[model samples]
Target: MLLSPTFSILLLQAASSLAIPGSVVKRADPVVQLDDTTVTGIANGTVNQFLGIPFAQPPVGSLRFQLPRPLPSYNESFPATAYGPVCPQQAFNLTIPSDLPAETQEVLEVMNSGSTRTISEDCLSLNVIAPANASVGSKHPVIVWIFGGGFEAGDPAATDGSVIVNKSIDLGVPVVYVSINYRTKVLITLAFGFLAGKEVQEAGIGNLGLQDQRLALKWIQRYIGQFGGDPSKVTIWGESAGAISVALQMVTNSGNAEGLFRAAFMQSGSPIPVGDIAHGQVYYDSLVNQTGCSNSSDTLKCLRGVPYDTLMDAVNNTPNIFSYQSLSLAWLPRVDGIFLTDDPQQLVLQGSVADVPFVTGDCNDEGTIFSFANLNVTTDDEFLTYIQMYYTPGASVDEVKQILDLYPQDPADGSPFNTSDQNALTPQSKRLAAFQGDAIFQGPRRSFLQQRAGKQETWSFCNKQSKALPYLGSYHGSDMESIWGDGAMSDYFLRFVTNLDPNGNTSINWPRYTLDSPNMLTLLDGSIPLQITQDDYRVEAMRGVSGLMLKYPL
Candidate 1:
């Protein structure tokens, strides 16, 4: 499909206005002129960075729960030198298992340290990092990154793009890197960005965060060429919540790419078995009651008028990813009739996904970290009740029993797989971990691949690099280091971003994933760092779990 005239005008202005002649200015700092604004960037040896550029109008005041609007044009010039404030993050009071190793805690803390930046509702900005000498019309492949924090907490600054850019430079495949910020939880007296219910669905304002991401992609299509990038060859990449966001982006708009991104790269996330937006009525009502908006006829409007501190307090009191509910998040993306026409997994089954080449993978034990919040469920009866209440709400006793049979209570058969009976903090800890990981992460990924394998190009991997870590084997988000550092996976990713295939001039070629030959590029911990293996570890169990989740959408 071709771009509209308005986008064509924006693209022409962004490219022509930004083309600077060599003799015009001689300085260490790099600069690009777009529309009427002049952007000055920092010169860091291998890459030049332009940070904190606004892509959308600030979503504040009356625009609180509304979809993001793209910026019309820039009127003034500003120094794009430092990162902007991050969107407000939802607070979670979690209790990590006391028996967890100190090293594990340190790793988790380091991963989250970047989110300590100041936060604000006016944060709808993005960052760009390009090779040092990249100029207009250079046509470098663009990689847009989205950070992940379970859709509740995360910032664009969480991962550094310098590692990937620098490595690409060394490998003779230069590329441009971009990361964007979107609303998460709101602090002011208003419905959260992900608020859901009949009112929200009717207003067509649910999943505001996802809407924010879509607008950013449109912004990229209009302006990325100014930074010497080929918007036509753009790739959308993310991990965890960001990965889930990427998957949703692929599946939304009736599987249309809309000339925004040409490919996708996901880590630890896929199209989940989530149902209708109306399913979140309880949380929406709770927010309305806590904000004292139940008395008003226009409750949504009343929520918009609530005080900031009161709204923040109510949002804080809700169940977060670390709550006893674990993966059942309170403020999350749902099937809002407009943006998401149906459940994500159902969309995949209906063939409503973008026909693009992509990569999706997970860590060996993607459940252990989330299992910590449910340490109270020590007995078999308590475990059954917890599962029935949270996951299998409408499932019968026989169906739930069938699920239990597939995932036995024996710790030896649970997560941190192959480590027999060692890391069960409670009697049901590992067992619950296995189930949650499959339900939320593994099962959805496998199902998505099986459905889309022959239809489009696909590749998958399993990161077991940190399998030696105590309770949390190769836990969720552990592969982040490899992508953000000068590691093997980093090279593979660079190859993918530049060539669309993660194999070229390398001995170990990554084969495309298919239903008949379900191959995986496994990252391990021994002297041999990488190997090819079948993605058939828990075939029958995963099939049973996927079927149950399809019947009982979360």
Candidate 2:
């Protein structure tokens, strides 16, 4: 998704509405034959976009909580010129803290500015944008994108992939781009894509969003060649929740790539330290009771029968990304015995990780944006209690104390890292920002890379742009424009997708990250736009957080 320069909007609508009066005429729409179906796509200058093509059958009715089922066949013509309806979003009614900077408050509101598109249960669709001239024999490398909205909201329409497609053409490494729409929290299956508890566990239907993505990958493998893409050279990429999805996809199915993708590029996400689907039993029960399914023997079936609006109202009442609970989401991916056999961190430790070449990184202050929800946590006692109650309930007192010692209360030592003694807002605000940033974003990413360093080719980056933003620093999702808006990151991404390495033809040599060297491509905003640095900031703190996460999986 492309954020506007002022950060006033999280997703900039596509510029397809622009008009040039009589000077511009619509080009003939491009057509591709997929099996027996004739698919028509909009011809947008040098790129042709095939939008809203369903890869799986409509996941409505009895299919609400079940795993995605591939469409048996494509026997009809499709006008793939517009995006389909998005899965129902779990709305966020969080209030911005009055103590925060006005700018920070505006940004918080902007981040939660949800989409205006139609919402429906029949939203398992994928989109493709390829060179206008790409024929069946073109065989270009393909990059599939998974959007990030904290796993509660998002859709394919949030991003305009043609930017990357056009950039690839300009870079002389033309490639195809694809984005998918998967069910989010409001699916009628109690949690739609991420329903949990023993019922979902025994049924083996957890992580349905990831399942939807998997099905989309399978669809691409079977049909992308018709759109001039080489199925064997596919790269899966995403940001935030989408990035976490990429990491989980890498480790799931016992690390098997399943011939779906050969590479991955993740930003601001990693395999989180979450336990089994049963861990979400409380939330599942709450949904059941709220949706009037508590009396039913088969709650899953009862939920499926509930009216869509009623179920959505119950889902919306749960904790969202912006709620006081923050990143402790009510609905998210978990270790289902079938799709995800173990805790993601445990899976990594057991060496159940794909050997695909990949790139993963994060912004400098990933937690500041999320810290707004906890503005009331001022005193040190409140901070410690909050961590124990919400973040790591399983950690022993000594371990939580160790975490507190590592992440001190001094504002100078807090996030907006170098600003020192500034942007505090409240006594514990900066402290919480530092700890949360490392615990969730920085710590997990470092651990994932360190564990898989030598096993496969790897590269890492730290986006430090917008470092001066008050209270928020270079907040989460800040680096989006660099990749999606034709910045240098886009060039690096295209290079990585096409060659399995991000170095060729790039202005700077992005060295591979290794255990001993741990190089990170640091993105800056000044005269030195880029620099190579060791990924060694807060080593002890991050290591402590990683250990705590393993011991107390969220």
Candidate 3:
């Protein structure tokens, strides 16, 4: 008996569902029923597990590139055991050569690990891990985590919340932990073009990825009570791009302030300069041309009609690194008149940001991690030339030479005859590292502190301990080891997350950052911690550059 066409299609769908990992097994629990659809998770003696819970409707077919719409509540219980599909992303698993520097190899190895490689477009789901013993009325403080990938790649499923959950239990906090995934790549940026027109833009809103995050927060506010969490006491935390998103949420007033989050923990990323709609329009037009879509009255209709794979391929082909190799593509939150009213730096300067407690800092050697991207400089002449080419492009040749002299290269550094060996020591690397570090990380952090010091509680630190294979003095992302426990730095993070303080009555006294007397806690080598009375010379240098750059409008 041959099946009919409709029956054949249904059979194929059922077979596909069975082929995929349907859901995770649930531990026995009295609180929730142990059905095939629901799974139970136990961590630190607490049993709770939620999987495949939809915060928004699927962005497929007609909805592609449009703002996410809220998922309708299902009358029947839905399976939420396994994580939902990851949002589409380009693979970032570039192989490092065996003979590369140990620090470079180590950093690359960690980044290319299994946890980072498994990314997909269908990954717009979130997970929650709470104490098993938590009752409905527990009202524990909730921590909502947003992962970072330079606004390109990352998923909440990559991080395991067991450690944070256990530490929270140990500290008698019994908190709930939530992690979410947002849209990325072209899906994030191309949406920005719709901000110009009113009618069409309303239907196909820009910043759909951010809108996804806002919807997730709304879900937490509505459903967190079921998981024994206090929605009013939620703390938004993220690293890199995730941190920047958290900062945007705090500053924006687009219905995000309905008692959603009370505090914020921004790790590495902050609101720096992002491309405006005027600048972004060029990229949008380029994408439209690449796709060969019709420029009809319904531009979004034509864009949405394009094949997903075709659009994704275009995005992957787009060059992310700059031509001169000075900076990565600045695809971040823009001042879209909605989420962002003005530049974050300006907002911070004017004390316009919400007066929430902020804890921010950076790794000691951020630029060192990005050393491979630097244009190799062998001599003081070449070093100055490189700076002039990349940094002071608009200045006259003589003016560029003068600026180079102002920040001259060191005398004794050796030159690399060939480009491959340009990894050799040069004053260029040191100066670039200092300039990039200050301009990108340290200066912005200082500016944030200066503006928020007297008005809000702020804490800052400079992580210096390195677990680099050859020890590169705590380069970029070393602080993650402290939070995730891949290295010795985990204990401090455990203390910080669980107790809301990194220092737990230890010998080291972690002081709060203030405007008049700004002190930074230095995480040094060995067991002894160091405190710098005044700002470091590198910081001062960067501050000077930051001041100079501020003179010109961004």
RMSD of 3: 9.2
Cα lDDT tens digits, model 1, 1-554, are 00001122223335644666455444499899879999999987668999999998987778777788888899899999989888876775667545568977755443333256887778899999999889989999999998787777777765567667878899899999999988774521123568888888988898888888899899889998899999999999988888888999999999999999999999899998888888888888888999999999988888777876777788878887778988877777889987789989999999999999999998888888788889899887888888888987889877888767888899999988889998888889999999998988999999999999999999999988878788888888777766665655877888888888999975488899999999899988888888998899888889998998898887
The residue-by-residue lDDT of candidate 3 on 454-481, one tens digit each, is: 7877777777765332323455565664
Error of 3 at 11 (Å): 42
- The global C-alpha lDDT for each of the candidates, from Candidate 1 onward, is 0.82, 0.86, 0.58
Runs with alpha carbons beyond 4 Å of true place in candidate 3: 1-26, 29-47, 93-98, 112-120, 187-204, 254-256, 294-298, 321-326, 376-408, 411-427, 467-472, 486-507, 529-534, 548-554
Task: Provide the TM-score for each candidate, comma-separated.
Answer: 0.93, 0.96, 0.80
Off by over 4 Å in 1: 1-27, 108-114, 187-191
- Ranking of models by lDDT: 2, 1, 3
What lDDT tens digits, residue by residue, belong to model 2 across residues 1-554? 21112252233433443534456667899999987999999998889999999999998898888889999999999899999898888886667767766777777777867778898999999999999989998999999998888888877776678878988999999999999888776532228888989998988889998899899999999999999999999999988888998998999988999999999999999889898788899988998999999999999999889999998888888888888878877788888888888889899999998889999999998888878788899998888888988889887777788877999999999987889899898898889999988888899999999999999999999999889888889899888878876665878889999999998877799999999999999989888888999999999999998898888888
User: Could you arrange the candidates by TM-score from highest to lowest?
Assistant: 2, 1, 3
